[model samples]
Target: MERVIGGSDRSAVGGRVPACPGPQAPGQGAVARSVTVRLDRRSLRGWHIRLLDQLGQRPDRRVRIAWVTQGSGLPGNAEVLFRLEAAIHGLPRPGLATAAEPVALAPYEARPDETVQTGDDIILDVSGAPAAPAAAPVWRLDFDGVPGEAGLLAALFARRAPVAALRGPDGAPVAVGRLGAESHTVMLAAFEDYLARTITLIAAALDGAGSPTLPDGAEAPLQPGRTFDLDGFGAGRRAAGGLARQVARRLYALCFQGPQWRVGWRQVVGPDLIDLRRHPEGGWNDLPDDGRRFYADPFAIARDGAVTLFVEEFDYRRGKGVISAVGFEAGGPRGRPEPVLELETHLSYPFVFEADGQAWMIPESHASGTIDLYRATAFPRGWVHEAVLVDGVVASDATLLQHNGRWWLFATVRTGGGSYSDTLHLWHAPHFRGPWTPHRRNPVLIDVGSARAAGPVVARGGALIRPVQDCRGGYGAALGLARILRLDEEGYAQRVETRLGPGAAWPGSRLHMLSAAGGLEFIDGSRPARPRLLR
Candidate 1:
């Protein structure tokens, strides 16, 4: 076979890299090691990658590899890996064993980041550290629901995972993309998914290649459930110092990864049979509540009215995710609940309550990517989607509560471009109608501990209580009981005195929560009664 050297030829070529005898792994606080480069085509770098895999994280997976390059603002800005004997100067003058050649002269698999364009050439002048080489200093501030939560905000949204350098399930490393501020919400979520999916990939890669096992990345303190000390991280600011900035930088460097991140899971309850007497259509269809093909978030209230449960009924099967209500008073109910508010598609987070002699509702309207409130025009049977309190939300499951003469709203944000099911964001308004202002500390609350919204119900004791989903164990497997100590401009602070019973609700390894309910009410929502065929 003619040795198809480097350049823009999309062909399969193979070679091997020599070995390195330096540091073996990149631990939480460890230094990176250099690998031996061999071969002739930019393929040598490819070879170097393969060599590193044999020296992988665990014996079973390929070693994760990342190239560090000084960033360029221009179009083709990235380090181009090439063959040892490839060209350096003007254009390529290919020789058997020449001085060097640019990877731009290489085949697809032999080149780095597969999308390199033709006009793009290698610039070898600069060198920098790979992502895993960065550091993450501890953050002590807890944005207890105030504004300008710089320290905590920076830390919470910091791209702090070493995902690109981690081996995938097949012993291959993740392809790293450009790194900088994740300015948009979509980028943030994409980043989070990247990190998480990379980990899974590494795990699968390792399994496939008969390599050693890696620790579950999602379960670590440095990952999905990352912890920050509340001392350095509160709603109020401490002294502004270079130290804070340094910590932020270190975190960005040390823990940042391709997938931006957050956290999930708690004690998930079932798709209990909601007496659909409200949806008098009768057998329009029957659905289960076991949480099979659907899940829901509901609030039960008894006003001058009857016991009504407002829920966001999600039909993963029908894909027609909608919002509806079901009512069942203690007297053993008469008829099945019916669907009241129906939409074409995309509606969730059906949080219902009565205020000022009127009923109000908020459901997850992710399609519009905004928050909307509805008014019950005709008791429990009819609702009109009236107002949009907030728009451009990259978050879900919003909660609005009237507190201390002012109205406070809580919602989980997918910060650092990670999972929508992770990270928490807060906001408030003087009135429920909301000329709503983002809590100065927008994501005033965080912690995979309760990053996502479980429920923000108030307690009978007068002090506020929030049921937090403890995703540490897994989604909805456990719950945390948090007491809202303060929610004023002074900054919101919370004391999670206890974690609600881990195995108290469902007999599984997960949990899910929606909205804040008042005094001793059974949370209700749409759930499937039987197991789902999750294809």
Candidate 2:
């Protein structure tokens, strides 16, 4: 780069930038010796340059780049000054390896509204070839933080090339709209840096008219008390994220692994809440009893005189899968218990219903990666693999309900997370048999409170009332009631409202609750009906 100091050549192409003018030259604000006003054109997303000379602070050690966003209000040109030493005990750090801001050259050649983050200075080499208008010089551009760069740019860096030479279908490096992720996030990082520097050089030549000079002693300290900061996973960034992460960890521990299961429950099995195991017409063995510890779903009442209760009993201490069922007299021996169905490996969320005189059950079939429907051959223990409703699918806690004359299935899908209790998707069909269509607004509902169906039941008022687990405070945090306000061709609309909780009754301190609740009528597997799975 050649330069003629203090001449008309100062603003010529291929010239050096005039050194940051010491002690002023009118309204212009440039103190760096070699800064150019022109650059190689590239991406124009949210780019801006910080005028350090205008901040009243001298560049001391290095520019600390903190990509901070304003919490509220249009803080244009309002530098969100952050204090470091006070934020942390001293110098803060981040989870990433490098802490210093990446070094960068300016970019004004392609755009004017370039808002730059302060101190973005780490200089990594990238393997990428820029794509632009036919005559635009083939170049590389740095992309600091665009979202999907992880997959695209990272792969490019893995190619082990400091520069990626991707051309167009015409094998032309310089063409309009020919840019794609060179491959990996890191590669993209390097590519962005390379181009940024090139663009800076170009703009410098244009601004200085080929006469540029580097500033002398431009390094000075910044704002008073501006120290280092760290964040949630380590480096202090924002206060909101750190607290949110802690809240998430605590929730996972209390829900599935909570001691509520360890403390054997003394659920009174007769008619009402406090009837215990004894009564005038029924003894401990008088009321129907299913020796199972937990009901996978509360018992479902058949229009006839039979009550079906699906129980989730697993030997977590022994192995992974263990589930069976128990049948009790609806109004007879009361406590006499018998086994119903013990699946081979694992089975849960048993959905039972007697439709058109035939009994059907669909348990949580997600373990097998398929949804299978079973038909009861006998009242107590006989069940056969009646139908393969949905295969190669992932549906759990599949509860069935007849709504708007169509059968709707609700389940929490295995959509890429451990918090299965959070999101719920819906599928509907005119017949309980085949052709299930996913809700157009599939994830029509999201609110940890009612994401998972408690158990499907036809409300006494003839409306579909679904019990839901409220996870606002925590998982299984509370029991909630949801009435399907509207279910039609238009779509499904439901509202969840808090109903009962641990404070609702004795032994109900955040009780494992509301799978299904109703009345049953039958003596074991026989007559005199009136039976329901209470809690």
Candidate 3:
């Protein structure tokens, strides 16, 4: 009734694998082939069943999966297997294949209190039992090839799903963690970051320790063949509409929605409040920028009764950003903005802070695969690279704050392969620059609506307030203010209090970054940019 088959082997009669009866509605076509799924007893949980269920929903290709247990009987084996069979039945035409390589389902052991080195591949021995109690809850990682770091990374990237399918023994869904960054070469670092954060999220979910959040638009049920749409650009609709719609949509995206951003600012009277409705001219003051370049992530610092505003000036021609600063007085700007820091690669989010009576900055240098700190040698004009706080990773918006006798660093880092706007990570140290320790819950937040750091964290009324970008609609679509409830070496937590969007006060389509200093608040928004045609 059941047989193992190699991946490349095919049926002899029609050059196509035989169809099998599936669990879909009557009159649906049979499945193309059957594949054997080897479930490791150690990691046999609900997620495996969920994954199989998802795979069955694809209309183009249907696979019949044969369940083969690899390890000894466990407590939840019967229930998990039953769910898996039910899931298979829910698809269109499910049957066994005559010849195909068995898909291996295995466990990836992660500890809540320890770091997991993702280097070696492990096998499941038939005689082994489930994991111990002290270990974190096991979640099945489904793969076709030999288990290793590369294989795991490949599977994740191929899936392209923001959240992994994981569940506890109780059949309840577990919160999955991710490593979010903005670079291309540090996927392994992202994997390590994911492992660490997943363990923390599992522990917190079990003990009811902290409030964990999932990325916005991440609530959709995982479909077997469906891919996560990063920009919600109606790709699925276009794909369903036919080839012509797809082509039209692609062309529309290419012509209209090219890269562009604009900066806006208003004066504030207090630390805890920002009223966009009360601008000098009943509207936001737009920073003057040439059509070729735009400004964003505006940060202001006051020194000796003078205010200096720094922003990320991105030139569309060069396709990179440089740090620029402009002086401001009581009425308006003292002069035009001038470039202060230029690098070979892209830079943004000029997070500036004063420590030890000196000015320092940590602009987003994720393109270089590191978070580098810079020291200002001469006020707002000269800057030199000072230290590398974290390396071998793509970290963005390196916002720094000093509180409770310790210094903290916050950023939205890309850990593996996903959107760069979702994973918020934290680090801490005793001094502004030195050896830093990653939080046990490294990815403190994963919500696309509020994960990316928008501006500096400010202390007000015995509480810390953090500005976050709400990218649920799109990148830098809105701004959110969160109050930190708990933050320590063991864990982290926050609650978003207010969300500000682009509208009456600021006439634009997006509002992302926010910073306040010397009773002035700086914000940025996006507007339609005129397209430039080449001669």
Best by TM-score: 3
Provide TM-scores for the models: 0.45, 0.43, 0.52
Misplaced by over 4 Å in model 1 are: 1-295, 331-334, 501-506, 514-520, 524-535
Tens digits of per-residue lDDT for model 3 on 1-535? 2222211222344355333445431112323222223343333333333333443343332222223333332222122222222222232111111001122211112123322112211111111223222122232321111121122233333544234323333323333344342322333233334434433443333223322234553432333454432111133222223423322332233324443467876665443344332333456677887655678899999877878899998654344578999998656677767999998766788988888899999998775778898999998978999999987676778888787889888888764335567898889999989688888887888888888888988776678888889887766778898888987888888898888887777766678888877766688977654464322
lDDT of 2 by residue, 1-535 (tens): 1111110112334554344545532112323222212121121111222221111122221221112222111111101011111111221211111111112222112233333322321111111212222221112212211111121232232343222221222332210111233423332233344434333432332222222222332221111243211101111122223323432332222222322221111223455321211112331122333322322234444335544444554332222233345443334323423446666535665677778778788877464656788887876468788777766555667878886678887887654223456677777887888687878886777677777766564464466667677756554445566777877655767776445444312232343334322343211111122233232
The per-model lDDT (C-alpha) reads: 0.40, 0.38, 0.54
As a whole number from 0 to 100, the lDDT of residue 309 in candidate 3 is 93
Alpha carbon lDDT at 71, candidate 2 = 18
Judge candidate 3 against the unseen true structure and give its global Cα lDDT, from 0 to 1.
0.54
Tell me the tens digit of each residue's lDDT in model 1 across 170-271. Answer: 223222221123332222233333323333433332233212223443211122333322222222233123324433332233222211111111221322
Between candidates 1 and 2, the TM-score winner: 1
Better of 2 and 3 by lDDT: 3
RMSD of 1: 22.8
